[model samples]
Target chain A: MKWLAASALLFAASAVAAAGGGTRTNDDAIVGDGFAPVLSAYGFFSDAQAQRPAAGVTPYRLQTPLWSDGAEKQRFVYVPGGKQARSRGAGLLDLPVGSALIKSFRFGGRLIETRVLLHRAGGWIALPYLWNADQSEARLVLAGARVDLTTPAGAAISYAVPNKNQCKECHGAAGQVVPIGPKARNLSAEWLAAFKRAGKLDAVPAVARRVPLWEDRAAVPVADAARGYLDANCAHCHNPDGAASNSGLTLTWEETDPVKLGVGKRPVAAGRGSGDLQFDVVPGDPDHSILAYRMASLEGGISMPELGRASLDPAGQAIIRGWIAGMR
Target chain B: MKMTTALIVAASALALAGPLHAKTIDVPAGNNAQSRLQEALITAQPGDVVQLGAGRFALSDGLSLDAGGVTVRGAGMDATVLDFSAQKGAGEGLLVTASDVTLRDFAVENTHGDGIKSKGANNVIYYRIRVTWTGGPKETNGAYGIYPVSSSNVLIDGCKVSGASDAGIYVGQSVAITVRYNYVEQSVAGIEIENSRDALVTGNLVTRNTGGILVFDLPNLPVMGGGNTLIEGNMVIDNDTPNFAPKGNIVASVPRGTGIMVMANDGVTVLGNTLANHGTAQVMVVAYPKAFTDARYNPYPRNIALGYNTYVGGGDAPGFPGGAQLAKAFGGTLPPVIWDGLGGPKALLPSADVKVLNLNLPAQGAGVDQAKPALLSFTAPPMIAVPGNVGAPARLEERIVR
Candidate 1:
């Protein structure tokens, strides 16, 4: 099945190259129309086709991945009009107009949805596409959809695709629609080296700061693992620049303030989402923490990350619990 | 392909006109209606109107509008429905973050989260809208039916909301707001205004929720010190529904059957309202010190006035915890007005500072107990007015005509 999926991706890429005539200049790629320009001129999922990065499309991996209804995700970044990827600070290189961040989600070997983040003159805009059952095509989905499927663990679940506006619910940072997960701390040394070998890196810094992947059991400390998990799963909206900033909780990896990182901190207007707990996080007591209660709840009014995943992430929950338990 | 072509034409038209000319983009009813509507919203000019036809539109994801001065309208609240029962994504059913935007005459149902939420938007109006969950009120229901947070110059009128586990119509950390002529029921809190400033809540029918209405100022928020609010001329009755709010939320502290609860706020005036048939007190005013865990918050309820309100048929069955506490403090049945006169050193100033004027209910039926000493007064900082909502556009009254 893995081999079949890989071949399908390769075939889709070659087909896209054939359809768009391989190499194209930046000037010809006009995005005046919604995402049609992305499809026809840029050949980024045009014809509802599911395609991987052809020649210049570079695949990358994050140190930690956000949880999205337990779906497997594939990520690719494309520089606009075949431009070189240039590093900006410790984050992913500054993307030019027409640059695209493409992520495809799959459930049990079935392609489910592909989310594309397009960088335009106006800023970054997120567009999601739903794949058809036959795997032949995917169509741009603006409203968003809900699908019911059985996971590999045999749990039946309802998965939501998230609408265009829902995209900004997390992506909107510092009052702008921006990308997440490509920050300096999320890049792996090996991936950076590969990008440099591919001539995609403008300049790789010496001793690049790294956030250990949540599943990298051998290399990460318990505290670092917990923080990385939070950064990937919650910080997109819980950061100082994110939507939940009003709550006074900043889950970003860069947050140095202990209170903002939810140490014995109280909830502001969490309403009943507080789970009757007094503190957002209580050191040495997972049972007494509001964060643990919210994460464990499947109820509508009291879930963390608030949008995706109807079921609990027992492994993630255990990690958070263990971290809280071990805290002073 | 056809839809894409249409979207391109629309985009071209919008690009040519700049932000001046107003255009109408009609969205047909179908499975793809959500996509089409989203496309229109993305391509719409500043003054454009996105109109939804009279039909049920099935949507998998939520929708949003981020352009200023855009109006999204539908045939009627009941006629045009956006159903998200099978929602696959996360977040509110519709999220709007644009200033000067107006939404009207539509229903959002069964969302995975909030029904319609506007965040940090100014000069926004929600007119003749309905937000609901089909099932009865439960903890699994969405947190809010209609939610506007950290926004300014907001108006929500002639709307119906129900089946939220939290407040059905909730406005949080907002300013210059007006909520009127709305019907809210079967939620934990019928309508809640929290940590906001310069608000007016009146002329609404609030019933069957755990609590009728709430005005609160919580600690540890970016925007705090909510004051200068008026709650008047609303029917707050029979709010005896059990609380279904998740734990840890401040509203969970509210007793079931509460009519109006004012906590830790200042300069609030409650007048000319009808309160009836609540199992708890008709009105309760209390300080936040005992319940608060955040030391940064103000623990006093100051400069409050409660008068000219008609109260009837309450204290039949005391609510648990608070009601039980009130019963223990002041005999068997709960009072019409229970004031836990706990304040931050300011309680010693005078009994008249927090006035209860011309209340026709029995004097004995009102309870006031100051738990703290008056000698330990803490001076409060000056209240800051929440900016925005100046010269907001005229309210949309076309729904009444329709």
Candidate 2:
């Protein structure tokens, strides 16, 4: 500890850490219910500002990522030493009891907040750690924070960092907190195979139909691009076992029913989110659809994915509108 | 030996924590009240009281409570207020997802969505809480004021709500609902019990909304078949606000000045209510006037009983089309009781003393022009027996002062 303080890397506020994943991060935070006040206590990052991964931490990406006011996201998963994560079908990987997932949200290359999900013996716990102004450290904020930032499209917006309970609003299913991402269908097969070679995953589980990469959405089918976007962004809370299940509009990629996927479906309790639109999705007319209407709204009650977003994503709006317009 | 040591450690930890006893955690409104109040709620254990002190807590995000057997109390309805005029996130002001919880004596104002929503939280009580939009009735105001959905044994007593674009006190997909002694005004529909059953709505003063009281059953919901409700001893008056409900909502079809409208439900009894001064007919029973694809849904109102409800000076201007001409044809104002004459058990009706108009439509979804308006000749059946096992469980009333 004294030698590290004497070294120059300790005070590097914005500098990148040395490419040595030498030290294994702290393991006690993942196994216990104790709330570590500082993000450095978890030891998940060798350099907190540059977002470097420590030893036993593996970086991954989702095929279609949930957009957060155009913030860049860096994702990682860390299983305890000798704990192999099991995968089944296309569901979320069954990580061991002491596993943890880390994701940091960034805007203009400055780290805004890092969210961590620790799978303890009881269940998974979600914590939001807000980075300080100096880019040196982040602390756990149970109440979340609001940061004024400009989106990639140059729209100035007040970004909402979701609180702890809002985490379960997306990650929960069947009344229990669980992970929403890291499914075989969402993750790349190359990463799955490489992770199996590294002895982290038990096997490369078979996936029924993988979601098309978001980068190649325009080149792919319109429904694939549109439904994949919904699965990544809206389905987390719109599925049958989701927070918006009361709305009766399930947008999961696997949902094939037209009415269930908001085709000619009337809103249950949409209120002003309807935007005076009559149906959830009107074929050949995206402007008349409530689904596209809500996606384009920046108003509080009128917006879809009501939490974790404060700005409009033009790409998402265009994709959904195009898909709905293409429908016969 | 190792197991015995672990048991001993666990026992001692339980003794130290004492999770059985109820604890009171006070949260005063001050600097960083968002974090202070939200932290108190998230960390509150079962059987704990998260007491909010006397002041206005300006909140940015909606607060949530997911623990069972908890109580969130404020100093008083006027003393402590949770203001969400600057709210940035979440659909509702407060979301409770746990069972056996009690919320009382708090005012939630100007939320972006519903004021308080308890979803799938059974045996919940909302007593003396006030939810108001502050601004007058507008299309942009939040949908519901006090919304309890998909729960059982819900008791909403002595609450107040105003300026909701939708129903003020909306209980949906629930059973054993008791809504009593509530005051709702300037909302689209006051005191709506939708797609639910076994409800007792009494002693409520509903006024100045698009419609006063509504019992509706719609299609395509997870829960349906609303029936066996009692509406008695309420003052439903002067609900003449134009319909402010947004499009696509079922409430948008509610005509202005409707005293009590029952739609597509079975065994709904409206008794002993002083219904007065409306533009539409005082009591209207109709079917769901749309096409639905739900196989399990019944789109007809059935077995509706109107027992001795006092109707005074209404139907001067019917809200729907051709109402003035039809009333002129029938001498002056329309009758007090209006029926679409689509479906019925037919035995459940008002006595012959009450004036009635039967819109003998040919089929469902028929246009109002096709209506063969005629006087309903009623031979009254016996006084109906009230349904059993309605209202919230009697044990929940023990928590409130009234």
Q: Largest DockQ belongs to which candidate?
A: 2
What is the per-residue lDDT of model 2 for residues B1-402, given as tens digits with 9 covering 90 to 100? 999999999987556545566789999987788888887887777778899999999998898888888899999899999999999885999998888899999999999999999988899999999999999898988999999998999999999999999999999999999999999999999999999999999999999999999999988777899989999999999999999999889999888989999999888988899999888878899998987788898988887888787888998889998888987888778888889888954524665567778999888899789999998875544575566778999988876776
Q: Give a tens-digit lDDT track for model 1, residues A1-328.
A: 2443454455445445557675432222323334531233345543334455555667777887887767788887777543666677665566677677878888888888888787887888887777777876666666667678876656788877766767777898866888886765687777877876777666664435567876783467778888888988999999766889878888887788777888867776565667668888899999999888888886554578877676778778888898899999
TM-score of each: 0.80, 0.93
How many backbone collisions does model 2 have? Answer: 0
- Tens digits of lDDT, candidate 1, B1-402: 999999999989667545456788898778676678777786666777889899988986667887777888999899999998876555678888877788899999998778898888887888899999889897767778999888878889999998988899999888888888999999999989889888888899999999999988877677788877888899998999998887766777688889998877876777788999887768877666333345567866776666467888776566744345545545555556656655433321222222221112222223333132122222443232222332123443432344
lDDT of each: 0.74, 0.87
Top TM-score model: 2
Chain A TM-score, each candidate: 0.87, 0.92
- The CA lDDT at B10 in model 2 is 94
Positional deviation of residue A141's Cα in model 1 after best superposition, in angstroms = 3.1
Residue B41 error for model 2, in Å?
1.0
Best by lDDT: 2
Per-residue lDDT value at B380 in model 2: 49
Candidate 2, TM-score of its B chain: 0.94
Candidate 1 Cα lDDT to native: 0.74
Q: Tell me the deviation in Å of residue A116 in model 1.
A: 2.4
